[model samples]
Target chain A: MSLPPPAARPRRAPLALRVAAHEDLGGGLRWLTLAAPDVAAAAEPGQFAHVRCGGGLGPDGALGTRRAYSLADADPDRGTVSLLYRVWGRGSVWLSQRRPGEVLDVLAPLGTPFRLDPHRTPVFVAGGTGVAPFIFLARRARQKGLRPLAFVGARTAAELAGGEFLAAAGAEVAVATDDGTAGFAGTVVDLVVRALEETAAAGGLAGPSPALYACGPHAMMAALAAACAAHGWPLQVSLETPMACGIGICLSCTVPGPRGPGFYRRCCVEGPVFDAREVAWE
Target chain B: MSDLTTRLGPLTLRNPVLLASGTAGFGRELAEYLDLAGLGGIIVKGTSPSPWYGNPGPRTVETPSGLINSIGLENPGLRHFLEEDLPWLRTQGATVIVNVVGRTVEEYAAVAEGLAGADGVAALELNISCPNVKAGGIQFGHDPRLAAEVTRAVKAACGRPLFVKLSPNAPDVPAVAEAVLEAGADGLSLINTYLALAIDVARLRPVLPSVFGGLSGPAIKPLALRWVWEAHARFRVPIIGMGGIREWSDAAEFLLAGAQAVAVGTASFTEPRTAAFVVEGLRKWLDERGFATVGEVVGLAHRAIDGEEAVPLGQS
Candidate 1:
């Protein structure tokens, strides 16, 4: 399925906006809805927002590093953008404490957005808060009249996010959890692999090979990359790294190329999303 | 109207605010949010003779008021940069300071020589302070002899004014400063990132893969100011001060501390328009303070205290 592009807002400097809403998503997770028309108007699937906590990440809210988070959803008409993140460090913790109406500085809709040709099926594999871009992808796919299949996993059922959106998008939703408190009792990657095999065996789909879209721990993404390679599947992976600025200026999120290229690439620019083949999973 | 203009050796900048090397990443990255040509200069990422991939992952971590990073001077070789990046940089309309680093003195000279006649390049900034690499970087800055040798070699190859950036970790920073000045350094930029490390309490291992990394940001400003003050108090050379400069006051502090100009480094990562903001803010500050030129503030602090401000402390 093919859909029209989102409303275009010419790229400008990051804007400061007020938080319209905030919600806790199970343990250590947060959902922040920001009142940023510019960001929402320009957001594309798989692109992320560089979020700066109003207070620093240090004790007493000292100015710590500004961190990046993937956009979970963006409503241009509503003038809003949303992000889903897990509290891993001071930055996230500070973000979690933000209240509605509090101003937040953000650089948005950055990096190469994930590409899913309408001719191919998009199989989204996510772990924990990695569900961020997957949810956006699912919703966007639905808008295009295509239904993607998503494998959502977490430590337990309590930690899952956005599976309902996958179902609403008409996707075949598969859930897994480490503690077997969800649909499947294993890793989401295994569930995705089995599902792909079943679809292929049933000879039940039309057009190009199914494309795999995944965002999770490096280990999980690396595993998915290898699985996709072994089965000759097209895979696009979203990456996460400790970064200062989400823009390309900071070399903080640099990584070597997949095949030992001599120089480094800024993950914030060259990608927060990359073809699995371009990544040096090793 | 306040004039932000200041001179570094032969180059006259429109403002005293320079985008420190490595922070601007070739100038185009920050250009997305700013007018690149508006800055006094952009010290491009430190380049070597050949490409360097830098350290393995987990290269940076955030500490209180500072960011610790070990990027290992990852950059393309001189030839590739000249062929690809320099032309685009030329179009940015900013004074381009090509910062060169190497494991050997000849490598530095070769890279400097490569940019000598390059269109759009204004000068060369020799980075002898990177702590991640093994062979040379900080080693050259730590010894007066090695610092002098690198300066002389690059000077011999390039006719452009040479600015050797000094490391705060030098064994004798003032001595290193004097040696480089004596060896024909047209100007200097001080101080580079300080050697620091962090421990992952849970894992009981060093945070960065390199074991130790350069500590930058507001945390290192005091040390940088001290070094710049010390070097300026003793030498006649123009010094560009930088270390954790995040605001106009920080840049102004450096100027009053004896620096002719200031470079915004890690602060650029924190805010893309920091250098430009500092420039604008400095103009407001100087105008309100009734100063005529940025040069008037250079070495002003040295004139304030009695001649006894220099109780020399051992260099890091």
Candidate 2:
């Protein structure tokens, strides 16, 4: 059993892309569409764009350190790429304030994106804004004549972003909310485990083995990792870290590797998406 | 067009803007964004005798106008560099300055010895100033005698022009600069990141696993400038001033404060083409000021002062 080869690292340059559309999306979520022909053409699902927020080449330009956001959608025909982000900090706040037609400095199609194996059934688990990349993933999976099963979780129905987007992208969407305002009134991981058990009992997983793909709060991903390990499922997880350079140079975004206790891998180059077995979960 | 060509001791560069060590990652990543041969030089990430895992995450935090990193000088060992990175960098036509790190003086000397006759290695920078590591980094930088000892060891091991990087955490930076220069160091890369810390309020603990990290960015520019000014005023060696140089103005300040060359550090994280932009901007700045070459601007600020005393503007 040889491991699958890693995704090829994208060659990127900073582009001053024009914002085509911006939406509030209520409940703290903001969706942005940028006219980026090259990025839209080359970006794979789970790859991200490092965007410079707020300050624009001025004396306070130092305040504009690039923040990484997953590329949520790409329309090659439209020559556009979209990002879904929560206004979490100063950087995002700056990003949220941008209007349509405004220019953004972006370094795109970065990091190792998620690779879908056609031999395995694609199952995606997302928590909160972690649903961003899955939209792109679901769309790509659909294009390949695959029906992706997506489990999306949030604190409430109002915060549940991308569930509708996932459905529109041809994925079978399952929603879980902590406040019981959504489909499954429990944790998404628990929902996934229950679904897996029921599917196993019904022999619904007979044709192809289900592979778990996730991006979420650390605790949720950890729980999902445990569940996948129990079911002997191969899992791929998209991780989030405080990143300075979205490129591999700074080595700021590192996750502990499965090699041993001290060994680590660069998140930017190695992956934002990795085999759950490759990560040393604490 | 004004000449951007400048010399840092034994190394002659096309310009005075080099990518700081650790920020540019051996010229591969940044090469995708900018032309490698276009900049002054590239000082790659610190290379150790053996591979270092560095500190565990969360390794970086963004404060006001600054970033704190506890990467602990993590690098692929010397063998990997000589095998994989060096040849690629050479093909890019980059002026490669290898920033060498080690756990002991012997290890530093060994890396220097390995790169002694390596192709395309323009110089060697001894990284005794990295604050994140426990064993060898700042431990050598803080003490003048140890700083000189490592400098002498590497100087003896390699025939390349040696520049000893000084730590801002060092109690007396000039003292260490003096010691290294006396020990046969050709130049100095002044003011690596400052030792700093950030706490997580929600978790009620330190943000970085290392507890402390080195702070860099615009926050430390003034501190770095003052040190460069002092070092240049006292010593007659070429200095590569860094720590928070983001743009042409910041690069100009370093040169005015007596740095023959400037390295763009944290700025590169935001914009990969910052060093190239600085190079272009500096040339235009010199042309606008009627200066023919970058050397004319080096230490120009210090020349305005009269014999160690402050001379006010228009009184010189």
Candidate 3:
């Protein structure tokens, strides 16, 4: 089977963009829209923005590091790019407190983006805030005249953030909660596997096989990868490794490479997204 | 305008702001965001005789105003660097200082010897202070004898000017400095990340997989500055001071502490344009102070304490 070639790496720079809007999506999730025309125009699905969070541009800044966040959506004509993040750390708290019109320093359209194959059906799996990139992915798939399927998981219904947005983007979203306070009583991986098995049993799984796209906690993605491997499906995973530079310079963000044990690839430059098989999941 | 030109012994830099090794990778990565030809120079990531895969997952953890990283000196090896990265760096008009690492003294000499034939390489910075790697990194750096042995071997193998990167974890940094300098190193690169660790309270485990990573960023600035000052006071060789240099003021402090040139390391991770920004800000700072050149500021803090007219040893 021919794999999709790597996404074209777009040129990026640190842009000082104004916060166009901010929405507290409840459950600590925040939706921030920035007026970044260049970034919106250049961003592709699975790409991220490195945002300088808190304090002034100095060594003594509250958080002297830049935090990486996936682009939730981008509108080139509107000159806006949106980020969906959970206010978990000091950086995210500072980002959440940012008022409209406050300028933010961001390095956008970084890392290799997801390679969407036109011939295959798109199936997205996300856990918690991992749903951030899938909204953009679903929108892109819809634009390409493909029906995207998404499985979103969280601890509870209130914790779920992106399923509604995914649905609005024309994706069929299935949700699973750990407490069974949402869609499926079991894990998202179990839900997807059951759905796929039932479809095959009913002979409704004909035509080109569906390709799985995933982003979530490590355990969730690893389980999904195993299921996809068993079903002979293609899977691509977006990793959320701790990164210092969203660019390739700092080799701080690394994942085990497919080469062998001890071999690793830079998650920043090589990919925030990689073919599931290319990663040596623990 | 104040002259930003900085001379480190035999090497002359257009400016004193250089992107530190490991942080800059090859010039190819930062070249996308900033103009390579504009800065003083680019110290490429530590390259070995052969490719090293480095440490496992979770290589970095963020601390208060700092970052701990166990990158283990991962590089594409000497062959790939000379064949692929060097040509592009040369074309960009970047003064390339290749940081060499090895698992053995022979390996260090081999990589240095290999780069000796490369066209664009301006100098070699021996990285004997990488704390993340187990085999040959800080192992050579902590002991003055081992540090001098590797420095002597590389110096014999290559014709290029050698700068030995010092480790803060060393029991006596000045001892290592004296050993490498006595072994024929042209200059010194002070403070290659402090050996440190961070525990994840939630998981009750170390943040980095390697357990102990090198701590960088503003948290270690004072420690790095102290080492630079001590080394400068004891030795006459040029010192490339680095460790949490985030802006022009930080760079200025390093110059005052007696660093001939300053490298921006972790700050580049926060802002890729930091090195270039420092170049401009430092020039403006000097001009405002009525200093004619960057050399005028080098080691000025020492003179203030000594209460005597002191010559900048770096110029010698």
Candidate 4:
């Protein structure tokens, strides 16, 4: 059977954008805050922004590629979104060099924001630079006055830029490192298990089971999912897939989801966020 | 007052500029960023039987002036595209040239037969040049007989204008182009992405799960131009040249090299309306020079090279 026709997905609305702030968060990571006049004033916690870099041309007026990043901070009231990215590719390098007065072409409110039930405690786990989304999620969770546990994993102490923010949110914060360069010598999954066990041991789980939300390396998420299964915990995971069109047409950023066998879903349109159990972890 | 149009057998394009298949996604996503109406035509992503899961993860990596992608011919089966994607594209208000792909000669025929009556699909481009997929891809592209066979099959199955998108990996691109043209292809789309790969240092593994991937971008432009120019020198088939066209000068180069049209793939990722910009640039240059038409520039660059001459119009 010839494949079915493509779904005519909704076009992303154009955004009126301006760079609000630019800061180097140290360790090759820089954060940019952008204001979009057109987006819904209320930006959700788990959503991401599609960033367009200017002067993609290499000193010759050549074209540049576009990239998507999770919004680490969003104030719908202020019509601004914060983007945190690590210097890895040319896109990131160009982004890091961007100055404060510069303007960028961007589309926002992409991907479903992380979904969490207020009644269920949100347990956030992050690995390396994947911690960006969770930091925003932590803030939103706290703003709702729901204190969730956050386990942030980094290779070394210098990499955990959001540790203080997570701690100040009134959420129990645990740090882990594989090389023992900073906190416990292990992955974030280990730290999450330890924290959850302590909470359960203190008889804190008599109510609704804590919901797990994790974002990081595929290996790290797979491990966290296993830990969730072991503890009978329900989890939501945010994924980072290669995507050129945030609108889902390119079919470049697809991950196996709960849909069907070998059936894939777009990380940009369907979600950059999904229930952990729904994701088919390999 | 300008002759911006060109003919590829029975098909007539307003100008000699086309969007490459697999690079431009049906013209819907990029419509917002650029003017789709300005292009000669648009090529949708590769289509196949049933939905293809494509490659695992790490499908793209940046290498100098190019990008390597092992996206494994990912697309919803043709049925979904005819039903869901085509109608929406009609609403996007642009003429769409559908790019079709299949795993077998029979599969290609079936797709052509299926799209025969579809409304809004202005033309059909047969994509036999994809490099990453294990089946079908590069197979039909690498050999003249197979490429001609597929082209002939698809041409028999569909009445719409047919374009055979040629692969750059083949030894003699002109031979492959000629085979398909004789087999009934309406025109030729030259030089899809080159087969390439990248490595992940930390994981000590190939960056893409597929191990090998197709390289596209500015890096492959020169190579693509050479193939297009070679085919143009050898055949009269209207060639849609594309590789790493980012601006007007690049498009002009392709036009001068004998391409009736050109496609902008990787540049769209960087600037969505780049194809339109190229088209406009072509118009501006032609108007300033008072050439009165685009054809005057086509194949003009080859004239300067003393040794190279247009092959006799009917060389078999």
Evaluate all candidate structures by whole-model CA lDDT and list the values in order. 0.83, 0.88, 0.88, 0.78
DockQ, per model, reads: 0.42, 0.42, 0.47, 0.27
Top candidate, metric DockQ: 3
Tell me the TM-score of model 2: 0.94
lDDT of 4 by residue, A79-161 (tens): 77787789887678877887776787777777888887788888889887777887788878888877787888987777775
lDDT value, candidate 4, whole model? 0.78
Worst 10 residues of 3 chain B by lDDT: B307-316
Quote each prediction's TM-score: 0.94, 0.94, 0.94, 0.87
Encode model 2's per-residue lDDT on B110-216: one tens digit a residue.
99999997888999999999998889989999999999999999999998999999998999888888999999999999889998999999999999888989999
True contacts kept of each: 0.52, 0.56, 0.69, 0.24
Worst 10 residues of 1 chain B by lDDT: B307-316
Off by over 4 Å in 2: A1-12, A55-58, A61-64, A260-262, B307-316
Q: In model 3, what lDDT does residue B188 have?
A: 97
TM-score of chain B of each: 0.95, 0.96, 0.97, 0.93
Residue range A1-282, candidate 2, lDDT tens digits: 432221223435689999999998888899999999989999999899988887443356535368889999999999999999998777888889999999998888888999898988899999999999999999999898777999999888998987888898889999999989989999999998899889989977755778788999999999999889888988999999878888888888898976653378878878899999888888
TM-score of 3: 0.94
Candidate 3 wrong stretches, greater than 4 Å? A1-12, A55-62, A206-208, A260-262, B309-316
What digit string (tens of lDDT, one per residue) describes model 4 on residues B75-119?
A: 877888888888777765567887888889999888888899888
Q: Residue A173 error for model 1, in Å? A: 1.2
Provide the lDDT at A153 for model 4: 91
lDDT by residue (A51-92, candidate 3, tens digit) is: 988853344565767889999999889999999999988789
